[model samples]
Target: MSILDYRRQSVRTAAPRRLYQAALAALALAVFVLGTAASVDGCTPARDPRFVGTATCMTCHKGITASDLRDHFAGPHAAIDCETCHGPGLEHVRAGGRNGILIDNPGDDPFGATPDLCARCHADAVDGHAMTTHFTKGAASCNDCHNVHKPGGFVFASDPDRFLDNAGYVQLCGECHAQQTGEFLRSGHATKDAVTCGGCHDLHVPATFTAPPENNQLCQQCHASFFLGLDSPEAVDFHTGAFHPVDPAGSGASRCVTCHLPPQRRTNQDRGPHDHSLLTLRPAETNALIAQGMTPPPNSCAGILGCHDASVPGSGAPFNLDHPSDNTVLQRFFDQIGGIPEKVQ
Candidate 1:
């Protein structure tokens, strides 16, 4: 009776153990078969719906013209994978452009009003741009000036005479800075053959000036003078060493633009663009305008904040805007430079 009872209990336990072993074997076999299948299929796992290649993206993106494709291929970002910027397109593709929200499109917010998406790769440019008026003033963004599909990432590709001229750049900038562009167009710097807007300004950099204007490095690029204490020697020693005493006194106002690019008074007396004509407005010319009843005429010498207002070394008293002859120091300088030629006036 004891042997029979023990035998029946062992059979019940053995049946359950056998069923568990079979289930484990089946699960292992399934895993092995799936692994083998994956290996056979060029080592690609079952299609991850998150990331599909650019080729898959292009399949349904038939609206992208042949020329646009050529531009993308020829662009600076040609080597980069499309998903590097737009993000994985598998979800977007599966929905056949119906769920475009699945993909990241920087162009959706072209002004970069949101967090800068281009900053992922162009962090330096974005950081530099943050300090510029274009960013600080909410005027422009990366895509506002740049075209990702262009070779140089510039939006100048739209111009009929692209790359061969700077008209495109001027036109682009003029879209926003109309008054400044107008002034620049009339200035001596606007020679079509040389010295366009880009020569002085870099959009990606802070303040747009290629170098700090406070130090006169921007003007010094074209106007090489011993006054700047630069490497080159000047024929005349007028600005710093002997003639002008302010710079030696550590007065930071001794910049080239202080005299040459004096602020031109606008119609409403709103602080207008500096005189782009590059004219050194003489005290004599200012006095002449004063005599003609045009009081407080737009002249560099008098308009300067601290120069003539305080006693300049040679000019004994504060400069007399009333009498041209009274302005001995500046008039003598004008006389030396051929008496403020009508060209500058």
Candidate 2:
């Protein structure tokens, strides 16, 4: 062949070889990319060997150790590691998960390591929260009501209703208030609403039971118009004649439940809880027996027990010997003032 023909033939062969090489390179690149993706998918960097999950994380949570794990952790996510709540602890567990790599990056793939991430499990709680006056404002979170590793236990674990029965209900309420539960038990409205710790309070949203406005709002929930005329100028004067003290802020202060029906004289057999009844005696006839001397000291015709101190005269009308007479006058006064009487003859 000629020299030019030879050159052309070499060029043609070299062109095909170059194209084949280029194709092979492309295939190799694709394989590399696919392999890289698969590796990333299968091995999520293999969480650190030292990583202790939530169970281990709970070891130090002394405060929540006594809480009900069954109520709070009874779900699939319960098995999730504590690092999931705090963050991936590869670096943390290696260095000890305290103040280590706080996988708090919002852009992370799971995007659930943020403080707000707990909302996923607490969505129902968030929706039913009392109001904007409480945790709904975002000042609190699942951590406020629950410990990630340890919860507050069943708020009403002892109650049959799973809400709060009488005894268990009072105990939970007594946690924050050492005196109020006892007073509430003695109040007239106790049996009417079958009120208990869970009656007006939501343990999960403690503010619903604690906040002043919230407390009054809860009272109004069952009271309806109990305080309707309370703001009027004559309300104080009128209530004074009908109720023991009439002044909400006075030494003889009475709540709405106090005047309508007062606590019974006898202590409860179970928890010394008061029995609310309008009559001084539970049956009214008991009051007649006391007055007739059929019953002894501490028992009276008015059904009042130990309330009469004839020597003290008017030290306290309700507890004084003349209480029955005073109560009668007051009842009449209330009737004249358009106030409803207790209905007991």
Per-residue lDDT tens digits for candidate 2, residues 186-239, read: 755465545665655564453555323212344445433434444432444454
Candidate 1 Cα errors over 4 Å, as ranges: 1-48, 60-69, 98-102, 110-115, 158-165, 225-242, 245-254, 266-272, 282-297, 303-306, 309-317, 320-332, 338-345
Candidate 1 C-alpha error for residue 68, in Å: 4.2
Clashing pairs counted in every model: 0, 4
Worst 10 residues of 1 by lDDT: 336-345
The count of residue-pair clashes in candidate 2 stands at: 4
How big is the positional error of residue 51 in model 2, measured in Å on the Cα after superposition?
A: 7.8
Q: Note each model's CA RMSD in angstroms.
A: 17.6, 20.9
What does candidate 1 score in Cα RMSD to the true structure?
A: 17.6
Candidate 1 residue-wise lDDT at 268: 22
Predicted model with the maximum TM-score? 1
